[model samples]
Target: MYAPQEDTELLAGALVEEPVPPGADVLDVGTGSGALAVTAARRGSRVTAVDVSWRAVCATRLNALRAGVPVRVRQGNLFDPVRGRSFDLILANPPYVPAPDGRGRPRGAARAWDAGGDGRLVLDRICREAPALLRPGGVVLLVQSALSGPEQTLGRLRTAGMKAAVTRRRRIAFGPVLRDREVWLRERGLLPAADNEEELVVVRAELPV
Candidate 1:
């Protein structure tokens, strides 16, 4: 639901540069709408897109067909469907909304967009498990928000034994998630009425060879 041009552009640029090299395997975790996976497939990577939502998985399949790219779309949580498999590159736009009480998400797409109590649940899991799924010299590209603590995400990657860096960042207008959270925070006096800025952070990390 928070799909944006910056997300698409970042994936496009990464694929254009062939970050995984030719004939490498790539994984698009949380491939909502299949944008990154499809783009990577078009660039000749053997791509697999994974999502927990059946609707998302179906949408990705339909989108791949429309794009004429043979991307493998799987319905599973995170890396569950591809256990024991490793990829040369991994890309993710995980749900990072901080839902302290787990009430911020709608029932249908909660798994797709909710990150548990602190909004870092999915991200933390990804960081913890990604190293095992990455091939030697493999890289992981993750996009998250400042609301989720950009520095903390980077730190998680480093703690997971990956060489991490913030590859790109941009000031994004308040979307629905942010707007809703702002309202909630405002009601509790946690956020001031004058603050309305949001930032998106894109991080790239490499698994050691």
Candidate 2:
């Protein structure tokens, strides 16, 4: 319904620092409001943007028009429409909030933030699937909450044959969703008994030519 939050901004900040070559081919997974897609286009990279939500696709299209940046927008699960294609750079700010089991992949407001307990449902798949879509010497900039286990993301990307690391991290007070789930998050050992902040991390995974 709206653009993403601090996590998205943090990833955008981190991405602005990467060395994207001129005319680089870039993919923005979960393009949402097309913020990062616009950024990539503005930086002179050819951009392709994707999201599973119809609203997000429309938002991305509108945002791109407003920004005067051309973005190839598609509605599909992560990487599906782009299968068999590789890119010089990829960006994602996926859902990483830990939620209860049996809560199937959401389709409404919660779809933008809710992931299964442990918060790796989408993250793990990204680690497993993204490396294959990177051209040599390419990179994927992924952002997630530390509660989802950045180490796990790092390890999985490395195992998938990419060098991955946390390049940026910031802690912020719980948003409304997290605040609402505080009790369950605490019970699941995700949030500390006395802690009210969550850390967001940008994971940079790269392939060597």
Task: Give the TM-score of each candidate.
Answer: 0.89, 0.97
Each prediction's whole-model lDDT (CA): 0.79, 0.90
**Structure candidate 2, residue pairs in collision:** none
Among the numbered candidates, top TM-score falls to 2
lDDT of 2 by residue, 1-209 (tens): 55669988999998899999879999999888889999999999999999998999999999899999889999999999999999999999988989888888776877788888888889888998998999999999999997888999999999988988899989998889888889988899888897878999999999988
Report the error of model 2 at residue 199, Å: 0.5
Clash tally, candidates in order: 0, 0
Model 1: per-residue lDDT, tens digit, 47-132? Answer: 99998888788889998999999999998888999999999999888887666574654357556556765668888988889989
Task: State the weakest 10-residue window (summed lDDT) of model 1.
Answer: 1-10
Error of 1 at 103 (Å): 2.2
Off by over 4 Å in 2: none
